[model samples]
Target: MLDLRSQAAATRRAADRVGGLTHHLTLAAAATLESVARSQLRKAQVDPVLELASNASTAEINEARRRRSVRRGQDVYLPSWREAAVGLPNLFLRSALFSVCSAREVLVDETIATQGDTVITMTGVQLWNYDRRMFAACLNYYRDDRPLSSSAEHPWVKVSLWQLAQDLKVSYGANVHKAMRESLIRLNAAHLRIRVKRQDVPMPRLIDVAFDDGYLGRDTPAPLLRGSDTVAFRVLDSMANLFGPSDWSAISDTALHERSGLSSWLTGYYSTHAGPFKLAVAALHQYSGSICELREFRRRLKNALLALEGEDIPTDCRIASPEISLLL
Candidate 1:
């Protein structure tokens, strides 16, 4: 309890600092976005060309065949911000969905579903879920200062200025919100020469590191963690000091199994690395401590697995969860 209390305090401090920055950055983005919208509207009114014309048509996608067919010194060049701006209309529609987050709502229309009057039925559970995801993004970026992966899937639903005030109904214990804050701060720091539907606009932009790293356009994923040698060494040194360990053996099995201990520590630590996540999973390996925790955790995971049974959730997709755990 004391540890959680301290964590709550520290998390609050971390969140406040990031959230303060995020608030200002988001305000700035709102202004910039309004200007961009007006500019886009003007362009649309003036230009009749929609989609790419024969003269302007670049390759629509990065294809293996296309890669093999490119001529020497004439590789296909896409507008730098190819898909970063693709989600604007979708984002605008989703904003309306978030606007209606009331306790009276039952089932959430998480996806916009269609382009019509988007009224999402927000449940308490879904609201809490959205809140947690936002808190995670803020903390993930601010305190952890980590790069985000596509898997991270930080929510981009910007609550309008009025809606934001309402969304602040809950305070503290908010990882997702912290991540949102950090992501916003990062976005506000970068300028993108975006070509949305063939018009150039230099705007402050936010993109998932996957997109920013050229995952979609370039097709190869980029590293999600960035740090200098000194920073990396300091992180290692900090982990050693915090857990009072240099190696796996030094961390007691019991200390590891305690959710408040190593496992929790590594959930934030080595968050992007399969190896450290493996180590954390191994720490849970010998845990025969309680049937209830195992059952609850396993049941939740099983349900999640079932949802993705026919979906592409991994590299090879041949192995199941426990089998993957064995590899861990």
Candidate 2:
């Protein structure tokens, strides 16, 4: 009887937490949409559409207009991290890499990734969630620009750490600053080897094309980062190619901020293709961040699917766990 009562209380608490999160996410999504609409309106040279004649269709027309405006004004481009090639959620840890929360240095010549015919190796370094955010931020920064050739001076992009923290919905603190610095170190020290079918591109480390201004070494200065500090980094040839607009994915800021990293990655991947996409449960596990064991992951995935149903968010995808299919 005591066990039963404990389970019931736990269930109620979980329900309450989910409800609160859902409400907060809903409000955030609405605010983002409103901001986007206002920005579009200000940028418009003239009224977007004819004032519709019938009052009955006015709501429908406005909704349609809003959808079109969002597509036009608020599109954020992201580079594709396809699972078959690079591995899904490209920077996350698999069971083979390290413990879920550990920051231990990976040994040199470690096989960090094995996708299709490609096998990527890395040195002793840890890639954390903050590193993932930093990379995404950099990619988004240069999304609209053309990738420069090998000879051109690398384009330097300057961004304030505070603004980046806000965009990522991460708290700004000394630890955050340290995390950012560590991310740069890990990324710079990493290497990649790509082999597709029978062909191979020369393997290259990320550092070949990217590096910070002057903060990598210990002698740089104390408080290596600050809210007001602006860091400028140049994107070189290979780096530009890495972030180049080949096949791209789109993930909304609200989705990234509100959902788990796995969910956000799944959303981005699904957004790339039209669904009712069918796949096995194993593939879903592999593609999403490999955090939880299968049983727990399935439970979490089911809840995500249920919560998404009939929600007013932008995704057209509907997920059902029993069938293991996503209908978009």
> How far does residue 225 in candidate 1 sit from its true spot (Å)?
40
Clashes of each: 18, 1
lDDT of 2 by residue, 100-134 (tens): 23355666776653223444455647554445555
lDDT of 1 by residue, 1-328 (tens): 3343454445445454566777566555555555665665665443211123234333442231121111112222211111111101221221222222223233422332222232222222222223222333222221211212222233332323222222333332234233333333333333322233333433222332211211122222324211110100001111111111111111122212222322222222222223422333322322211123544645443444343333453322212343434433
The number of the candidate with the highest TM-score is 2
Angstrom error of the Cα, residue 15, model 2: value is 72
Q: Which consecutive 10 residues in model 2 have the weakest lDDT in total? A: 68-77
Q: Highest lDDT, which number?
A: 2
Q: Supply candidate 1's per-residue lDDT for 226.
A: 16
Error of 2 at 117 (Å): 6.0
RMSD of each: 25.5, 22.2
Cα distance off (Å), candidate 1, residue 265: 14
Which parts of model 1 have CA positions greater than 4 angstroms off? 1-129, 136-271, 275-292, 306-309, 312-328
Q: So what's the TM-score on candidate 2?
A: 0.54
